[model samples]
Target: MSLLEVRGVTKEFVTRGEGAMARKSVFTAVDKVSFEVALGETLSIVGESGSGKSTTARIAARLLDPIGGSVVFDGQDVTRARGKDLARFRNNVQVVFQDPFSSLNPRYTVERIVTAPLTYQGITPKGGRQAYAQELMERVGLNPDHCRRYPAQFSGGQAQRIGIARALAVNPKLVICDEAVSALDVSIQAQVLELLMRLQRESGFSYVFIAHDLAVVRQISQRVAVMNRGRIVELGTRDQVFGAPRDEYTKTLLAAVPRINPEWDAKRRQKEAT
Candidate 1:
């Protein structure tokens, strides 16, 4: 069985205009999207800004409720998990938001931020929370001595490392990276991606990576799901989706990626001809 499965998940938002004359309309953010992520794998959902890829990630993370369908993780239906069950489910799943600056609290020190999950779940680490948090910071490429520093003191990349460290503190089975590196500089983004891949190799954690960048998705994900208008237009292995996209939307998205080498098309053509 897959580690995580999202079956026919749907989400809608009701918007109502204020004042004397107002109209209510239901906006479908996600429509019957289904996919699965296996253990120690990365499943990336890529699309444009309003394509609902992030919404699907939110539902899978249990940060938002799905209006329809169910999310199953490790054979348990967690769509409506309650009380201790819900808390346990949350412990096994974690999220790293897009923006590090806003996702982390400016007032809290790095140690406190990384150990917050353990504190909330009432889990005391083997040695101590402070030591554990410092170890996590070092694992993510941050200075262990910087544990006493706040979010504002770190660079964007360093702040993101802190966020990643916090996500892994609970030793979650799955981590939802919602545009986790999109906000960083290109160089920094590559570093973060490498860090995530290395960490995954060591910890055996799966990722539901949500992003608008196709190139970034190609680098991190084993499987790719292309979303359009709140629906999945294509789903397949990275090679299958990138080399021979079956959906028109997927093709369009691939074509939009900027090429650093001007002869990239010629090289592709030559390689395909052979």
Candidate 2:
């Protein structure tokens, strides 16, 4: 069974009324989008800005309710889940935001930041929170001794590692990465992505990775879904999307990639010559 299913979801925002300027138009941010993610797999939602990629992630994470359609998790209808059920749903699906600096608490120590999720979930690990937090730190490539250090003391990569550690604190079954590594340097991004993959393998967690960079998504995702103007235009395996694009938009996007790769350059030159 699929781990998550977003069935024909639509999200619309209504313009607010103002003095002598009342407006009632609906801005369709997301339109009739549907997809599924299986357990222990990574599915990437790829799109440029304003393509509703983040909106889809928000819906899956239960941060926003869709105007039309349902969100199901692990065969349960989470679209209408309430109270403890809603809380449980939220706990099971965690998010790692785009900017680690903005996401992490400025004053809290790494220990507190990572352990906060466990405490908030009312989940006491086999050992104490401190022990769990330390283990998490070590797992994410941060020194356990640095748990007491504040976010200000950590670099961007380290801060993001802390964010990953915090997200794992609740033992989430699925993680929604909303451009989680977009702001990091290339090397740091690679390191963090590797860490995320490692953690997922060890913990058997699923991922809905949302990003604009197709190259980065190709590195970690088994399948890719392309969203354009509030709808998914194409969905396929990484090789299918990158190598055998079936949609014109997908082909155009692929054509725009820099011809720095030798094989790609040779193929393009051949095409041009022909």
Candidate 3:
């Protein structure tokens, strides 16, 4: 089942000329892009910088209103949902941004940050927020005792884990990860990817993972969407897109990524199978 569907969604920005000749011109950031994310599946949108992947993420998450087309979430057309309806929609979808530190408030304790969503929705956990926050911190591999620490006290990876914990507070149906791991070290990236996959297996939530790193996408995605010039040039299963790309742009992207070691790849596949 499709948890989220974006059909022919379009978003444009008006840019003005600098200085005396200030004239407005429309720049389309997302051009009639369309795709679907299945329940409990990870659909990765991969492309170079300025390829509209991030813009598409923002539109799907309802952070940016589309100029055209519709967004259907779990059978509801929430393209222009307002008031209580918008709040309801927000409770079911959350975003984890790229910069963990910037995303988290400097002054707020980890406990407060993790439970902010619940507070916004006026829902309290069975236990108090602090206890729930500690549980969430543990689930995301953080020290539960450190819940009182501020964001600045944690390392980059630990801060990202806190962000993950925050996203899970609402038990969202869909998580839009907009370059969520791009700022971390490669080792930290792998750990976070593993954590994300494990959480998906446990919670059965879908992810719209937007990233430029093909290697990371391969590790985490079941399906792939290739975007270029504000349009999706190709979309298919992981094997179909990576093994036998038909689009010229997709092929170029694959060609640019360094080949993974076959031995390592085989071991990884075996582990997945087990």
Best candidate, lDDT-wise? 3
C-alpha lDDT of all candidate models, in order: 0.93, 0.89, 0.96
lDDT of 3 by residue, 1-274 (tens): 5899999999999999899889899999899999999999999999999999999999998999999999999999999999999999999999999999999999999999999999999998998998999999999999999999999899999999999999999999999999999999999999999999999999999999999999999999999999999999999999899999999999999999999999999998899899
lDDT of 2 by residue, 1-274 (tens): 9999999999998876777877687778899999999999999999889999999999988899998999999999999788889989978898999899899989888888998877777877888877888999999999998888999898999999999889988888999999999999999998999899889989998999999887788778889999989999999998799889998888877777654476864684475457
> In model 1, how many backbone clashes occur?
0
Count steric clashes of candidate 2.
0
Model 2 poorest ten-residue lDDT run: 264-273
Model 2, position 233, has a per-residue lDDT of 97
Lowest lDDT block of 10, candidate 1: 260-269
Candidate 3 lDDT trough over 10 residues, lowest sum: 15-24
Task: Name the TM-score of candidate 1.
Answer: 0.94
Residue ranges of candidate 2 with Cα displaced over 4 Å: 16-24, 259-274
Pairs in steric clash, model 3: none
After superposition, candidate 3 runs with Cα above 4 Å error: none
lDDT of 2: 0.89
How many pairs of residues collide in each model? 0, 0, 0
